[model samples]
Target chain A: MESRPTRRRFMEWFLGLGTGLLAVFYGGASALALWPPAPTSAKLQDMGPVSAFPTGKPTFAVYTAGGAQDGVFVVSQTSGPPTVFDFHCTHLQCAIQWSSGASEFFCPCHGSTFNIDGAVTGGPAPRPLHRHFAEVRNGHVWVGGLSS
Target chain B: MSRQQGPDESRRPSHLSWPEWWAERLGLGASWREALYHPVPRRSSVFDLLGFMTALAFLNQVVTGIILMTFYSPSVAGAYQSILAIDAVPAEHFVRDLHYWGANAMVVLVGLHLLRVFYVGAYKRPREFQWVSGALLLAVTIGFAFTGYLLPWDQQAYWATTVGTAMASYFPGIGSFLQGLARGGDTVSGATLGRFFTVHVLVLPLLLLALLGLHLLLVFVHGQSKVEEALPEGYRAKHRTGDHSDFPAGDFQPFWPNTVATMLGSALVLVAVLVALAATHPAPLLQQADPLNRANYQPTPAWYFLWIYQLLKLFPGRLDILGIVGLPLLSGFFLIALPFIDRNPSTQRRKRPFALAAGAAAMVFVLGFSYVGSSSAVGPTAAATTASSQAIAHPSFAHNVEPLLTASCQQCHSASSHSGGLVVVSYADLMKGGGLGPVIRAGDPADSLIIQALNGTSQQVTQMPLGGQQLPQSDIQLLSNWIAEGAPDN
Candidate 1:
């Protein structure tokens, strides 16, 4: 009688353990499948020639980087490489406009303002305007992924 | 499964009717009659019919949704087109409208039912799991709405889903994983459509049916709550033994003719309202999704989610988790733990003042916020650009249009990589037409395919530049001007 009860107890424990392990395995596998893999970096795109932009002016340019449309303001300096700024405001990602007279980039959505150098000058912008990886290659302006 | 025969079973006829034959074979005849003719509280009124109305709304949705599935395509490329085709047929479009309006009615009915149950303290004692199951059913109903909203693949569907999934991705550790699971990838592509379709059509419905069965079964087992007085001592022991003779002699009524009639009558009224609303306002389908138009178009969540949308606006960056994940979890925990927290056995509304006050306040807050959220206007709030300092008589192809094409268009529409059989490498190549037809017609920007594609006003193709971003409005206007200048080869 003692042996029979002990064997039943053992069987119950074994079944419970087996069920628990199965549940854990399934849950973990499902989570792993849902989790995203490491993101791949964006490639560079040719964004027309450097000479096309007027010197000492914030000219607007649009290009596709990493399968996304990115509007940027390229302020062509009198000398050295130009400063390229992402068009969105740092506060909420609204499109930023260039005002040559005020010499500042204005985000009309919330009145956030950034200077021509991409520094946050006024309003709710938490940081400076975002920049793109830019380089002059064979007279053409190549823009890569976003650089914070 | 053998059992002692009850008095009703002993009087069965020698020859069974068709339904009785199948029911007897299935061993369900007596049980079915018992369940259908079970006693309910005599005080049950029209308000108690909320659950039945909700179930009826769900049934309508299932019928219409199955019919729609016969024609619906669960693919990004085909979803919008299929909806358009459905709209062309009057009967199908009306059916679609019924499904759309039925979803809203079901949500409201569920809310009303939950409110009734809470007010009457029906979640006490043995009915705790019943409330829990009802809560899960509420969640599944919402899941159905969220997944179904993405099936149309129009601009409203795409952008609203984008914002929704992005909000879900703000949870601390598992945020990104939630987004990936919901969207099936980094972006809302074809994979997202397929995933949402499967969840909306299959998974959620099955889960709902199971939970609903459990919830209804528990209701019958426990019997409806007696709101007139508190339970006497030793009630729990008697309840456990299935002795529900606590109610007064004449205060009980059978569920079949009395309650079922009222429930079905109210459901008929709900059906009439849905039909009238659907006939008056068929579901609106906006333009095909344009990823590039994000800056110009405002994405608003569905009406029921407006309160949460408005709440997010209260918290700034990083702290958005408070509005997104924190509040929802807190409220959900509170809802599930209500029975434990308020241990009072009294079913009287006056006895539960604190609970009633808290519930009332929450309802008011949601309604107020939803009002504020809905009143806010949507679409293209982007400020107009400052005029250019210098205005040229005409845009030059070499200096202006060609470079713009090279920067934005040439990636997909160049000589070596002509995506749609149209090349933008040269003015001549551009004028030569794609597989469809000439993309540009001289001096007519309105008719030009390229201009329409750029501005996302084309009915023939999806928005240009495939990615969910648009060319700056200024660049698009410039292109329109260039084409209007006769698309010169210069």
Candidate 2:
């Protein structure tokens, strides 16, 4: 073992080290990519309180998450936390307009309408107005991501 | 230098080899190795490699599919769970992805193989069965995709199967029968899953293997037709009279070492690519199917079938008769009848202008249609900006005004026993008003006749819930509020 190394032996050792390093590098890279990657957290943005909204009328606010902006509806009836909704109509995605006297959200594109509680009330909407995440936390209603 | 040379002809290993000794002891000849792995004369070309690639793709699919099957459950209840479990296993997604990507590759490779055959005029007079069998194999490959799609039992799979089977019902006479056979009923049910699983696992594989065997046998027998040989006799006489030194036989390599080595290398490369893809983009699995919620999911067929889906959209209403049945039938007939119809057998691309143009045009048209189909507008008008991006979640319909109407009013104003011309069956009927007049003005339900009638404030109309106890004031207020809330059809 203590004998002087020949050129061939030194070359063999060098190539072996390189091959082992290559194998480990590839294995690690593949594992990082394929081995059930760490569960992803949702991209969320904070929108402030329910009390900021007036009772019996929807407060239209622009929710900007992931650099995309869209109108969101915040309705506070007997508020702890207001019911937050995607401000677009369920049927045709036109920005919904809440008529105070009529007490409903109407889509100008189509006649689709939704109740104050986000239920589709009329026209051709097959579902209710989509809701966003809103929860009462530390005296303030915080709205966040729609999905993970 | 010749591959056929032995170490020494006088002292051959064949006389004393273990294989020969075993063969003699077993009362069998020592020809098995030669029969199976004999030299292919090293004349392998891109066409041979393409054919080999297709077979490799098939082999990959079978290996991955079988491994997947060991974990796969065919029943409706178990399909999704099994998939989830398989996904949980380390590297299982890689195997499944390989199978998924391998399926697409198989279809593409088979297509390239066919195209290669067509260009070389290998589908000519003596080799007609090869073309026909290959066509049938293509059908079987697509059939495999169709059947395998339903195995996942997800919403996308379920609805795609529904639409696919429904389309089968449009063929003139045997359409219904075909639909029934595919579906195992009038609709997609547990039976459909059973049938699809059976076909996916047993039937298609059997058919494919048989056809592949026949296809390979014919190919070996014909020994891969040359471009010059594919030419018409007169054309061959005029342009290329002598064999080009460029021909394969001049260098003549053997298949055992050279071609097989390259084939193995390409196969390994293909598998590596599949692994990379699987690692990067695992095949997605949607939520398990909810049959009752069919309308909630958008159904799109696999990419290969997208052109037909796009065509269907182009042909609406009465034109559907032509789109669903006639168009596909015509194309299929054209494809199968190609060899016979285009008898001008000049394999040279320059010599056949019209045929090449027609083929090229068809390819462009199909590709164009597929591109449009996968990304085409689903409705005449777009609904939501996010609709195109992701699966559209169903909005909550639980709190819709319908429930209140159904509970409070339907008893008296039900369709069977309407007070006037009005029935409380649906939002439409309720909005249409009674025999008196329109009851609910969508946004202005407070002034609507139903509210007026319920409040007993209408002079002409009698109090609603006439025979029953008067509704709670809160319920009446709720009703009026809902009416004023635009009466959405949630």
Candidate 3:
């Protein structure tokens, strides 16, 4: 009996201690990991002077903020502010490209096409491309904030 | 095991032996050996040496670890510096090498020891807790390795840990939660480094000490199990009793000088080998850990962990939880519960065919997996190659802007020297504009800030080299041509 784990209650207490310590160690780490996400300070991107974008054409403007790449189609065809569509396609989330000949936005991956107004035109795209908050001020095109 | 000696402290008088001079004075010495010592089974051989090998390796690790602790710093800024400082110690070069070799040896010996215990059916019946404690000690040893892997803060340590912790996030139901727990926060940062140091130096050491104590106590109390016994059948018989005295007394030998000699010889040989290896090939140190610069890195786990890494590769991405969490946990649970489940006190290899085969198969599998993992292309290297190739298909700021910017503009337009509040070091910074306005205007060189500045028509200051020669007209045209091409990044 002496050679065995005969002290049953003592064994249970020891097991409890082991379990408790492991629990605390892992539990504390999990809690720390779940802390609120840090706030990012991404300032608005001022693309360029208004004259840089040809007024009658679909001029594609690309910019990066905080190492993340984003693009917008700044169309100044009419008298109003330029229409800015986010470069991400409605299908599969790949960055979209401009087709100067086709006069439409197309996904390089799945061939989803959209009209200049961001409306889905053909392919398997379910909806129009997302847009960004864009405005023309002081002869420059300022693109800021997502409007998905 | 004696205390008294001649006038020369190192030499013992020929007339006085340990039993006469020492044991007579310390009257309880007989009982002391009787209490602490045990009889070695007649069948004992080099195979039973694994237990001693593991213990000696552990002792080596403890000595080296304590020595390292005197100099190692726990903070992120100091971790790499501390290791470098340790290496810079004059004439005592092999101290760090001993720790590295000690850890590797401990891992190898512990695994071999476990296999010995398993093949002999030593976990059966009364020695169950010995097996349990041994299993737990195995885990703590591996814990020591895992935490220690991150101490140097080098490229291997940083990226290997990144891949390892990312693998942990594949557990079912609590996958991401467990990952968060291990990582401290979302990514491997200062917090993770500090905590892993604490675990490696303090927390794991304490746990290992306690578990080792328990393991040793259990071993001595149970006495080295008799591996010669094998029941007629592979099943336990009812009303059977365990009595150590029933074995023939002559078949056992007192473990005074015999076992002690074996332990000393084995320890000496292991240290000699380790020293030779360490002196020839020292450990490595790569570049410091930087999360953003990981594109060039190809992370791989340590050798012992390569089997699990290979297992993860074998499974689909969605079923990763099975390989990562389920497989190891299930195997651990089975080993822990083997005493209760098997109940067969058969030390004969033939009668315990399943147990022997299973152990052998596991060994083969782990070695095979490690072979595959080591020989294969580095993890994430293929994906990184594809991404780099795709990047090459587009316009590049490195090729276009870097030449003009470094020669004509880097003197004033840099991260350190952001004169005019403009930095052309990165495309992102170039697009953020200067004190006056944004720089390059895509598709229109006429309205570009950089082009206009070079043309020297700005309101703020002179831009055509305040003191140096103006950039040639051809160079200015090249810059204009790049802007007129939409300024796409490669």
Per-prediction RMSD in angstroms? 9.8, 22.4, 13.6
What is the alpha-carbon lDDT for the whole of candidate 1? 0.75
TM-scores for the candidates: 0.70, 0.55, 0.59
Number of the top candidate by lDDT? Answer: 1
**DockQ of prediction 2:** 0.01
TM-score top scorer = 1
Per-residue lDDT of B318-431 in model 1, one digit per residue for the tens? 566788789988888888777888888877788989888988999999999998866652335421221111112377788777866776777788878889898989888888
Q: Residues A1-148, candidate 3, lDDT per residue (tens digit)?
A: 5665568978998999999999999998876655423322234789998777766455666655343344567777567667777665554344455543244565533345788788887655556877767778898888765555
The most accurate candidate by DockQ is 1
- Residue pairs in candidate 2 whose N, alpha carbon or C atoms collide under 3 angstroms: A120-B488, A121-B487, A121-B488, A121-B489, A122-B487, A122-B488, A122-B489, B42-B253, B433-B439
lDDT of prediction 2: 0.68
Write the residue-wise lDDT of candidate 2 on B229-271 in tens digits: 4333443223233322232443344445766788888888777
Fnat scores for every prediction: 0.09, 0.00, 0.00
Model 1, span A1-148: residue lDDT tens: 4555587798999999999999999999977776554432366777788988777667777756444455777877777667788776665455666543244576543356788788887655657998877777898887766666
